[model samples]
Target: MSIDGNLLTLSQWLSPAFPVGAFTYSHGLEAAIEAGWVHDVVSLQNWLETVLDQGSGRSDAIWIRSAMSDDANLSDLDTLARAYLPAAERLREAERQGAAFVKTVNAVWYTSFPDLLLPLAVGAAAQRQRMDGDAVVALYLNAFIGNLVSAAQRLMPLGQTPAQQVVSAMTPLCLRLTVATRGASPDDLWSNAFLSDIAAMKHETLQPRLFQS
Candidate 1:
């Protein structure tokens, strides 16, 4: 694909309209809102900033780039991704979305690859197409964080404008991680956003929940 074509493909894959069912998972922002940890735009931004910087968001970026590498062992990578999930709901969220992504992309893009973890599936697909690695990882995080912000709108009083503003502020962090993770490997993956991880586990038992995780 040409540069323009690659850009278009990335946009479609990461777009809100993509059939990955991303909107249904909040990464536990729903539960966080109930606990008063993420009750407003600023708090929400802080929560997500930590996620992108020190949580699964950063970890997923590394996995994506790892899957894109020439010598990637996808089965091992997928297994590792599953092993690191902090909660059962988090595991379900990643598995279902990753499966849907692989099924759709295989039928639409005309290829065959086993269903893998979400980040790994995306990375392998991007590698197959020779897509830009930076764009792939950046936009994947963009969509991931953006979906959570959208979920926050329903879980809290955050309006569309404020929600988008949060996404805008988060854009730089996403881009910076893409650049930083260009040479990253899964061995370097880490998740220290304890609050986010705890929130994801908490969501498993949250009453009157509006999100899956």
Candidate 2:
């Protein structure tokens, strides 16, 4: 495929219209809202930046790059990815979205992705399709952050303009994280967004919730 072709494929796969059911998960933003940790655009951006920099976002990027490599351990990587998810709902979020992504890719593109975590599945597919590894990481991170931003929008009275502004402002951080972690292996994967993890775990028990996790 040409560069344009790869870019188009990445755009389509990462778009919200893709059947990953990503909107159903908050990545723990709901619990944060309940705790008053994120109520407006500034706070939301701050929380999301932390997640992007030190949470599953960074860890997933590392896994994606590793999986795209020639000799990735899909099985071991799968186990580690599952263990890396701190909460039960977090694990479910990754597994369910990953399964959906694999199913869609295999059905539509005739691709064969191992039944793995979301990041790993994406990495495997991108590798098979000959997509640029850095581009894959960047687009995946954007999608991840966009989903959480959408979640925040629904959870609060945040307006569309501010929400979009936040997303636009995050572009540099996303690109920087992608470049910084481009060469990372699974051994380098670690998460420091403990508050986000706890929010996700607590989300499992929140009543009248709009999201699954």
Candidate with top lDDT is 2
**Local distance difference test, candidate 2:** 0.91
- Write down the TM-score of every candidate: 0.96, 0.97
List, residue by residue over 83-148, the lDDT tens digit for candidate 2: 878999999999999999999999999877667889999999998998999899998999999899
Q: Write the per-residue lDDT of candidate 1 for residues 1-213, one digit (tens) a residue.
A: 445788898798888888999888999888888999988888999999999999988999999999999999999999988998888998999899999999999999998989987888999999999988988988899888889888888888888899999999999999899988988987787888999889988989999877888
Task: Specify the poorest-scoring 10-residue window by lDDT in model 2.
Answer: 1-10
Misplaced by over 4 Å in model 2 are 1-3
The number of residue pairs in model 1 that clash at the backbone is 1
Model 1 clash pairs are: 28-213
The CA lDDT at 131 in model 1 is 89
- Model 1, runs deviating above 4 Å: 1-3
